[model samples]
Structures are given as structure tokens and as C-alpha cells.
Target: MSDSVTSVEAPEIVVPEGVRLEPERLLDLYWYMLLNRRLEERLVNLYRQGKVIGGVYRSLGQEAESVGTAYALEARDYVSPLIRNLGSILVKGAEPVDILKQYMAKGTGPSRGKDLNIHFGDLSKGFIGPVSMLGDMIPVMAGVALGNRMQGKDSVCLVYIGDGGFSTGASHEGWNFICAQRLPVILVAEDNCYAYSTPTDRQMGNRNMVDRAVGYGCAGVQVDGNDVLRCWHAASEAVSRARSGGGPTLIEVKTYRRKGHAEHDDQRYVPPGELDTWEAKDPVARYERWLLSEEIVDRSQLDQIENRVRAKLDAAVDEAEKAPMPEARTALDGVWSTPRWTAEHPNFHDFAAEIGS
Candidate 1:
């Protein structure tokens, strides 16, 4: 496990033969990653100020995995993002202001102040909000893919699970079910070194999680999660395969969680210098270096992109601060639904219209 934390530079960016990204799309990836980082930084500040309703999960080193994978999906495809996957949701059309409001527990949030952090989902945007229980979204996403196939829609579902979450029975059951049914679902196994404080070696016998794909009789591939373009390449292929009825694919994304499980965690269990080592391979920084080295964006262009992201975050923070909280009277508003109430409130007829409902 010590080798996993060794100091290493980012891998060279290699574009697969069939994978082509225009300059505009490349810049878009960089922008989304920057936005993801800046937004989390704002959330950390809000958490310290006591403005946040719950813990803030930071994807400090793993931004590329979320952003790149989701970028490969079409607008019609679906994704189920975990707490650390705020970048994926952003790519799926979630607004920065809504994320801020959700963290601040403002009434204007996607969850209407009912949930905190990125626990809110927008079905219309093709994303399903995650549940607290790890691996639960696996079965749920399987059902989603099945439903899409039944409806004769050529859509795929991408579900993310952590190194630890992969150990759960729910994940196994869902993986088996999807493989047997030949469902159009891509399972992303995030091997981010630790599950809370437990290292990968302590939790599972197989260090390489992607190997399980063979047992499930599905295609699988392993990629450096830090390499944004590589992740995009692999995911794009997986999406194409699933869309073409090739069944499920397991993508093992090798990454590291630079931050603790949450803001409150000090990560005392992490070995000395481990975080620093991973810091050298920071995904966002690596991608920026690639962009600059390849002359994809000059320094001035990068600066402009950073400035735009910061300005958006500033406005989002201000709006979230000014937004009101949920009223006590509305506590039970969405708790239950009756035919009479649905008829009385025509606007609330489609509960799916509400994000994360």
C-alpha cells in the first residue's frame, strides 16, 4: 500500500485513435474542473463559517475522474454521482447556485432545503442523486437502465462506487444482475486508496477491482483517474459499447482522496507525506499543465477561465446567503402524496420535476 502513495508525476496525455476532442470541448473540461474545485473551496469556507447545514465533502485530488467520465456521456444518458462527484453533476447541468443553496440549506436549493450537499438529483438533467448508503445506487441505476431499454430508448447509466463501497453485498448483487441482464450500465470503481481511514489492502483480497468484471462476464478496463483525457476516452468507449448492446463495463479509476472523509476529519490515520505525494499528482493541476504544454490555452486564457469561475462562485455564495430557509410549516409537504392533494396542487403533479425528489 505504501507504493500507492509514492511521489509520481502525472501520466502523459495520450489520445486514443478514435477519441477526438475539439479545442472548445477541451477548454470546457478544464473549465468544469476549475469550477468544481472553486465551488468546493467556497463550500469549505461556508462550512467553517457555520453557514453549511452538514459536512462538506471535497474532491480535492479526484476532480478529473468525475468531470472526464461524465463528459463522455450524452445528454440523454444518466449518471448517479456520489458526494465527491459534484463535478459530474455540474457536467450534467447542475447550477453552481443550486449547489450553494443546497449546502446552505436555503429554500431555493434543488432539494428545497430538505437535503444538504450534492445529495440532490435532477432526472431531467440525466443524473440521480446518491443515497447515504454506499452501493445502494447500483441496484437503483440498474433499474434505471432497464427502464430505459424497456422504453426503447438508447441510453446508458453510469454509476460510481468507491473502493470500500465495492466490498458491499449490494454492489455485488447489482453487478451480477446487470451482467446477467446485459443492462446498459457502466460501473465506475473509484480506487481512491482509502475507505475513510481503512486502506485498500485491509478491505479486499484483490487489489485490482477491475478484475471482478471478468467474473461477472463483463468488459473491464483500468485507467489512471488523474488523467482527464484518458478517463474520457475509456468512458466514451464504454458508453458506445453499452449503447450498442454490448452490456455493462466496469471502469476502475485509480485515484486518491487528498482530503479526509469530510471536512471534520483530520485524516490522522494517513501516513506522513502520503497526502503530499498525492498532491504532486493532483488531477486539476495536471490537466492544466497538459493544456498549457500542448498550447491548447495560453496563460491569459487560463486566467480568464479562473476569473470566470471565481466570479460565478462569488455570486452563488451571495445568492445562497440571501435565500431564506425552509419554513417549519412545510416540513411535511413532500413527506406524503395523496390523489386529492395532487389534484389540489396542479403544479406539484409530477414530483419528478423536483430535483432529488
Candidate 2:
């Protein structure tokens, strides 16, 4: 007898104590978030110094979504984080040195001198290409989960996108198929207020992207992207559902873009008041306050975490700079080195099916 329930809905999981997390895990969790935040700041400096020749989508104030969600996934799970979700990558064990190397165009980068930041996939760690093109990878994520199900593997597929990507027809198509097939894919929508310069209000008809999930026979939840605990809870539930063949869940994280969208955007249109409001709710600060109130950690401990993160960030920069640039010929390398895109597509099933078949 097999425990397979055919329903077009998200699977539910009772939050186990192990996964529920407690103050006992505070130091680890706090440091992880701090480490990622400090890294983002340090990388931005690298970007400015021209050490990072490519570009970056800095999630300056949105650290909670990345670190919290990353903690929920098993080491073997697959994550299709968007460009802005690099924090998620870092949490999935992508080394800062390697990340900096990619930014520096180093040969040892996970992309192997191919993808310079955007296109990302690391088999060893199970985190795949950020795949910048929105809606492109949502269905692909579902397909990965489907393959895992067929192979009797417990891996779950997570797809990440932004507010801008949601406007595309692909979001609709991807969710529809995921529902009909009941694949285990989690779509994390980090609504960072602005998609480039256009505010969410200006870009989309409805402010809440989470509401759209209901139409597709899927479940979606809106959580405070800056609230680490909330993010962890939501993602953990989604992970449980997917692994149990519950199907896909969409999580719309309400957060703000603390950076200028990308390295190039000036973001001059942003009003000062709006920026100040979000800045006050900075996830790091919120989490720290919670830690203090709960006595999970104290000021000295928090300070130590900050100092350590800064040191690591500094070391990553040093390592990145000492790293060699990808060979001068490497400029042409990223787009075509792999035959995955060159081959004729078979029916989109496994990633191999989508490409090699």
C-alpha cells in the first residue's frame, strides 16, 4: 500500500520540534543572517571598486527571506533562486569565495567561467542557476520535483521569482501545470517593493501577488519578508508538503529592495519617507530585538556575530581580489559552452529531458 493522495493543493506538515526551531538555535540563525547581510554589503563595495566586473541584484534589507528559507531546506534539496535571492544560495553552502570569484570572473567559479552571476546551477550543492528570465524556470522547478517523485527520491524543487516576473504569461502557465500534475515545487516571490524603478503598485494591477495562487488551485501565503521566524515557518511547511507529494506552494514575501535594484540603477525616484520606513524594519534589527527580548542572545553575543561576519566578508573580498580573472577569452564563454540549450527540446520532464532527450 502506498500513501499517495491526489489533490490539487499544497501538502500540510505539522511543524516538528526539530524543525520548529528555538532560542537554542538563535546564535546560529542570527549569525547566518548577519553573515549574509555583511556579505551583501561587502560585495556592493566590490561592485563599486570595479572588482566585480559583472552586476548584482543586492538584497540589502531582505536578508530574512534568503537565510530563513535556506535553513528550511535539506542539504540535498534543489533551489532555483532568482538573482536577488543570492542570500539563499549562500545559505545552501555556496561559498562566499566562489560567489566573489564568479563576480570576479574566476575560473573556479561554479559556472566554470561560463555564467557570470545570473545563470547559476551547482550540482554538488543542489542549487541551480538563478536563471534571470522570469517564469522560465518555475515550470522547470515543477519538472524537477516530478522527476524526483518518479525516481523515488525525496528532493524538493524550489522556484524563486520577483514581482516583475509575475507579470509574464509564464507564471500562469507554470503554476497551472504544477497544479494539474501536483508537483513538489515552491515558488518564493520576494516582493521587494520595486522592480527596478517601477513600484509594485505601478507595475501590477493588484498589489498582492499571493492572491493569484488561489486561482490556480494552489496555496499561497504572504509573510513579512523581513521577519526571519515567519519566513522559516512558511518555507518549512512548503518543504514538508513538496517532499510528501503535496504539490507546489507560492510564498509572497512582503519586503523592500534596499539596494538600487541592480548595480546600475540610481533609484532616484524613491521617496525618502518610503525608504526610511522600510529601513526601520530592517530584518537584522527586528531579529536582534527578538533575540534580546527572548534572552536568546545578548548584546555582546550579537556584537560578536557582527564582528565575525565583517571579518568573513573582508576575507572573502581579499580572496576574491587575489583570485585571477577568467581568461580574457572567457567573455564569449558563458552563453554557449553547454549543449543543454543547443539541443532540440524533448517534452519538458526532467532537466535532462528538457535538454538532452
Candidate 3:
């Protein structure tokens, strides 16, 4: 994983029809995927070197789950990324330099160094920063969708959660609320087969997460999480239906976590041969091979694109490294806001004065 991105193309790979993207768009997708992989690898190195300010999480084998669903979204659509959805964040208008800065806790990061390690979001880009709790973002996402509905906008919100989060009280509460309201939301279960070290078998009695959707009366579809095009198609349909008058959709993407839960996790609980099996299905490599064999891109062109991405990421790291730290006094900023009740209740001012004392 420390080595640079590989351009090795798998033999005998064929993409199913209708989901094939144009050559230029396919190249862009590859660029974004490569960027994410490289950036995460760099983060791991930084973590090992004790430079990263906090725990580092990598998308690793699940790039397609994020990139594909994000690719299906429009500029006006909303996304809430979990810890492992770096590809989705990058695709949703977050600059690599900004992300690196965030991890490095630089003053110039999205949170202005108020937080560390992927805890920031830019709502202007239609991305909601994730909450620390595993499944809390689901309800927040539903609220965003409800707001879109109230405004009569066609925007739909896509939120990602892990398999472990599937059983969480917040997950159930959020999904139930979204379903009951018929909100414009797409719930993506990135079933990586494990919640931390615990396998899905130990976590839930129902292995089929999409079937849980039937209870909510929303459309549910499962896909080959490693197949970027398939994931994209499923997400596209869900997004389209949600944007229209139709309702929410629950998409289950079956994938595996090739690494531990985070940089700190050693993953001793994983059984032998499991990693190898999922590694063979590496989505980025599969997409690269399909693009090469189908003549969508030649070897040299793909190499050039990768080289460009490598250079860009290197420059981003350098820029982030040079950024200054945030001033201590700045911590007081952005943590508080005026509450509606302050203006609504005349006696609230007296209560505020009493607390101030």
C-alpha cells in the first residue's frame, strides 16, 4: 500500500452495456479514483510517521461505492459522507489540498483547524460534514431532504453508512423518519462485511440489508459494489426517482474492507484469504482494465492521466504542509449561534444574563 498507484490491467475484463461512460468522462472518473487512492495512501504514511493529527480512515477497496454514487449526483444534489467515503468528498467539490490540510490540522483547512481528520463539510458544495456518531448523519440527511422537499427543489440527498451502522438506533430512526415522510433521500449501505472487526454475521441476524427497505416501502436494490458502472446505474435510478415525486431508495453495495477500520487498527480478526479475494475485485483496477481493453483509453493515455494525478497530489501535500496552524483564540468562532428562542421569548434575555453571571 505504500507503493505508488498501479496501472496493471486485468485480463478478460468486459463491462456490461448501457453503463459505459464516454471516454473523456471515464478518464475523469479514473482521475478522481486515483486521486483518492493516492491521497489515502499518503495519509496512512503520515499516520505511521506520527504526523497526522488524528485517526486516519481509508476507503481502500470501496472506492467504487462512493465514486459511483457521487458520480450519479447533480451539482444541486446533497451528499453526507461517512468516514470511508473520501472519494465521494473529492468528487463533491472538495479540493485535495483542502482535505490534506484538514487532516494535517492546518489553519487553512475547511474547519479552520477547529477540528481534525475528515470532520469538516462545505454545505456550499452541497456536502454535509459527518457527525462523529456512526449513524447520526442519516437523520441529518433526511432533514436536508425534507428541506429540499419543502422548497420544492428537485435536489435529492445521498447518505452513506456502514453495515454496522445499519443496526444502530440512529440508523433505524432516521430511515423510518425518511420513509414516513417520503423524503427525497437515497440511503446507501456500503456493506463492507464488517463493522470494525466484527463481521456482519455477528452484528445482525438479517444479512440482506436491502430487504430491510421493503419494510419501509421504498425501492431497494443491491449491486456488485466492485462494479463501478453497476453502482452508478443503481444510484442514478435512485437519485432520479427521489428527485422526482417517487420516494426514497435503499441501495446495498456488497464490498469488503481491504484494510483495518483505520490506520490504528491492525485487523488481526480478519480470516486468512479473505483479503486476497476482495483485493482481486479492486474496483479501480477493474475500471482501468475495462477502459483499456474497450479502447476507451490506451495504456499511454491512462499512464499520463495517472502521472498527472500523482503530480497534483504531490503538490497538494506540499502546499498543505506549508500551511500555518490556527490561532488559539480562533477556537471561540463558529461554535455558537443565536437561537430562535432568544428572540421569541422576552424573558430569555434575563435567563441568558443569569447564566452569564
| TM per candidate | 0.92, 0.85, 0.89
- Please list the residue runs of candidate 1 whose C-alpha ends up more than 4 Å from where it truly belongs after superposition: 1-10, 336-357
**Where is model 3 poorest over a 10-residue stretch in terms of lDDT?**
1-10
Tens-place lDDT per residue, model 1, 56-134, is 9999989999999999999999999999999999999999999999999888788888888999899999999898899
Q: Against the true structure, whose TM-score is highest? A: 1
Model 2 whole-model lDDT (C-alpha atoms): 0.75
Error of 2 at 145 (Å): 1.2
Q: Which ten residues in a row have the lowest lDDT in candidate 2?
A: 1-10
Arrange candidates, best TM-score first: 1, 3, 2
- Reference-based lDDT, residue 188, model 3: 94
Clash tally, candidates in order: 0, 3, 0
Which tens-of-lDDT digit does each residue in 301-352 have in candidate 2?
8888788887887887888778765665444444555534332433224444
Clashing residue pairs in candidate 1 (N, C-alpha, C atoms within 3 angstroms): none
- Which residues of candidate 3, in runs, are more than 4 Å off? 1-17, 337-357
Highest lDDT against the true fold, candidate: 1
